[model samples]
Target: MIPSDDRQPPQKGLFELYLEDMINLRHPLVRMAERIDWPQCEQQFGPYWCPDNGRPGHPIRLHVGLQMFKHMQGLSDRELLDQWVENPYWQYFCGESTFQHEPPMDESTMGRFRRRIGEEGARALLRMTVELGEGTGTVAPGSFRVAVADTTVMHKAIAHPSEARLMARAHRRLVARAKAEGVTFRQTYERSLDGLLMRIGRYAHARQFRRMHKRLRKLHGYLGRVCGDVIRQKPYGQRSQALDDSLYQALYLLRQYADPKHRPKLYSLHEPEVACIAKGKARTPYEFGSKVSVITTAKEGFVLDCQALRGNPYDGHTLHEGLMRVHRHCGHLPVHTLVDRGYRGSEITPLSNVRITGKQKGKGTAHPEHQHRRNSVEPIIGHLKHEGLLDRCHLRGHDGDRIHAVLCAVGFNLRKILRRLARLFGLRFIQELLGLLRESGTQTGQSMNQVVSIPV
Candidate 1:
């Protein structure tokens, strides 16, 4: 069943005061809640729930608001839930009228919510933020016409892959599954594998390449024998489908890791979709994740769009698709897009109505201001990684990658909106204060001159 907010006033009890009565209305979160079109979001998200079914789920506002807070503050689901309990402001932001001591929902429910929404829904959330920026005047109308585009890697949460580690992990997974299925293996190699892994690490650290290679072969042999045993006992029923899938992946990795000529290697066993992206950085030469294309307004720095590219495609080739996404989401193509030298060879479709600008020097050069805006995307990408959750994604699969990138942009834009609102409120407060002082001076029957200045 679709969840709806409780509209009734809080029941009279020992303490009649409610959270809505206590929180300051001028707070940024409180004010932002009012500005956001919750009814529209509820209408859009309500269909995900069955009209008549299991226990009612949490309110759409609670789930959506919690997601906004999670990315804006860079808090994990567990951490966000804990903080929501102690902060009335957070409860109010989630459309709660009364404060509750316990968590509104379980932490695992967040993952389900993300899966239910999928990539398209995440994009809608981001689009809503862009619309919010336009409505609040933080992002000027038609600013989307002049935008900047760039690409960055959103790294996944996986350890650095090595021959020893891969073999050991495969061996452990196979053994654990065999034990769980009540299938007795010829030899588990449990004790010997542990000591072998220790020696393999020591050998690699000491630059004993030959010794490390020899031990890796032994580990691979152990994994091969265990795999054979599991396969021989195969006739797995429906219940063992997950175990069968695990064995299939282990065998696939065994083949790929053993061959040096494999075109695409597996970097992570759990996150098979993770790709190794190499952006020529001096400090970090290689990044393991998906490449993301980010588009932002040239002047206001509001994020226009964020899309995760599947393979590690060239930066130049991603432009056409990025521009198309911008058009699909915003309903208009940019008039001009500023990009770096990496996008030099790419050709934009004429139908896009977007003019791509790269670095230019002497004659036929772009205007100085337009050229300068190309570098503006650098800091925005940095904030997306540091402040947003783009640095390390915690969700699962390729869809998770796309959803994570979009949510990070959503978070970034929300933070910017909040900062703008706070600045506006501060200026209004100062003006009111000055007006009050002027009124007092007039009432005192004496001319009082005063200069009140406030830093932006």
Candidate 2:
């Protein structure tokens, strides 16, 4: 018979054995995570209880949440779930006892969980990251310094909508969804949008076009009656009220623009505030969402604040909120914040703390270092759009846009943390292993008896 040891499967790898062990001893983020009151931070999410006498799922929630947060930054839920099955590191992070066949929650469940957390929860997550950074001894408390500011457009996830098309689509979608959800109505239009689309798409003959427009007008009027009936009939309950509020808002905008007024109101049920913002870049002539300003530290490039401003306000106007977020994140106001020419204005110049870079009125000594540092944030904006998840907004409403931006910032910080952890781990591993090698006479030429200590 084979011995027990001989019969056993191969020993689990050091990597598979423990994730904490894989983490570098001196990695700042790791050290910071350990020091923070994660229990307190995690309390914001859960006190999940079991059904029978209800055992708490707090540990599971926290672990799973942190894993989700990582995934929200680095990968999709489907991709993360796949990794959890195969990668020990990911499984360990997610608190899996065994390689699970299914994810702890489905993708839709993940979305609901995010909604439950809402914008406030996302902000809390950001605060936790900032706090962790501060506790790490890497960033000094008061010295969380200059945050460079810039804006990028996050596109809404709907087809580019024209005024007429948007109104028609918005009206149809609201009615369809409302009806499907069992909301009562006196009348609902059975007409398809094909005719409306055709009429709008073809504009050759004035006489025929007016005939088509009259038909479209009748359809719009019919939709309005259906919406009004639904509004009157539906009970004033939580869910229905919320739906009604949104539907009515869309309907209001559509009707406001149906007949040409001084200004045509833009409306899209899918993404109501999807604006046509032009930033004047040669590559991207126009972007289809609100302009969001992101501010980050110059020292380590950690994002301090992000805001989704509607109507693409001038950069100078958003300064107060940006600076306020920096203060909130760092627990101290930033000194000598840097910005480009767009942010230069009398309103901004009054704040002695903010240092604006642009063409000087007269030739004077230029601080090349400040100008260089001012431009540093531009790459950060690109990274957020290209690599991080801020290129497009998957959610709807202004709140959704804000959440997307915050999640991107959080994702970026996590990536930063992972890179720092990997680098530190590698350096320490090489040093300690090299010393061990010297001691073991692994290096044949080295004196075996000599004591070997790794240099810091």
Candidate 3:
């Protein structure tokens, strides 16, 4: 259901005026809110909802505004809501007729709203930003024809995945869940596991590899004992899905312990889908998370498309899908898809009429001006990571990863548009000030002439 709009001026209460009256209308956020096409937003996210089911949710503008606010400032749900209550501009931007003294919704409700919209809805939000950029003249229409592309790792919010830590977490999680499922065990090892894990860490830090492996083996044996106990009690066919999954994880851990080198390793017991990607960096040779590919306009570096590539695919493998997304967003394929040497040996070198740059030397000579633009994407990716939410993802699962990456892109565009608006606002203000000074000067000159004529 669509949220009702109450932004009409006539409905204002006698005691409380509208937020538009209280806050500066010239502020960028207020100007931006006016620019956004709320009807189009209702059209985009309207299909997800049934017109007659449940009470109408909050206004689509509020949800989209909150999404922009979240990424623009790199804030979590709690932080955004806490400030939303106090910031009249934020309230006004979200279509609040009057100031909000209390939070509009709980933190958990925002999470549910995000999930309800899902990945496609998130992409719609990104599309809206692109439209806003084009409408405001912040991003040029010609720049969309040529885009620079790059990939970066969006690290998950998890600790370092050491053997001892993985084993201990698996052990504790399995035992606690089993007890909840009414399974009794001998020597649960909940208390003793922490001390053993601490010791393993200390030994490893002291360069005692042999002792660390020894304790690792001991922890592995204890986990094996728990697995044996559970197996003896509950048959595989009769176990709950979660119990079965835990049992398999335990078995996988045992297999890794038996053979120190294993394939398709599980980095975190809580987040099993995470992968170890080695991007050939000295400081961060290996990052354990998903790979995100971002495509931006060559002219102004506005994010045209962003995708989270799972399975840690080769950088070359992700180009086709990313460009296709770009086409979907911009309504046409980029003529030049510029990338680094990482995408040198890609199979789809010639993406239709689009000339893939960065592999050939003569290509740079052909387009000298845009050759340097490829490297500009690095700062865009850096900004998305450091300034937005892509540095460390807190959302769960691959869906969360996709949505988060797209929202960060939207936030980056909003930041650019805000700066452009602020620049225009400042220039206008200066022009007004100069006009006032000139008018006052003319009046003073005319008055002085009259006084001089009288004295003569």
The TM-score leader among the candidates is: 3
Error of 1 at 440 (Å): 1.9
On the 0 to 100 scale, the lDDT of residue 118 in model 2 is: 72
Ranking by TM-score: 3, 1, 2
- Per-residue lDDT for 1-456 in model 1, tens only? 888677446575567557767888888788788899999999889998999998888889999999999999999999999999999999888887777789988889999999999888888898899888888888998788788889999999999877778777877887898789887887889789789989999998999999988988888888888888888786556328767877877787779868988868888889888888889999889999999999998888999889888979888888888888877777888877877778767644563333345444554435444656777889999999999899999899889999999999999999999998888887888999999998997866443232224334
Candidates' RMSD to native:
5.2, 8.4, 2.3
Model 2: how large is the Cα RMSD against the reference?
8.4
Ten consecutive residues with minimal summed lDDT in candidate 1?
Answer: 447-456
Off by over 4 Å in 2: 1-37, 43-73, 134-143, 170-192, 202-264, 346-352, 361-368, 440-456
Pairs clashing within candidate 3? none
Can you write out model 2's per-residue Cα lDDT over 1-456, one digit (the tens) per residue? 110112113455543445555444465444434555645654655533223454333343334344435434566667765665665444444443334455555666566556666777777777776876665433455445566788778887777666556656666667777776777765555565666667766752445667666756666776677677666666456346556766776567646656566343464565666677888989979777888999887777778887788776888888887777766666677766777778766234443266667656433443334445877788778778777778877776888788778878877766666666567666788999989987777655454334354344
Each prediction's TM-score against the native?
A: 0.91, 0.73, 0.93
Clashes within 3 Å, all models in order: 0, 0, 0
C-alpha local distance difference test of each model: 0.84, 0.64, 0.85
Overlapping backbone residue pairs in candidate 2 total 0
lDDT of 3 at 354: 35
RMSD value for candidate 3: 2.3
| Top of the candidates by lDDT | 3
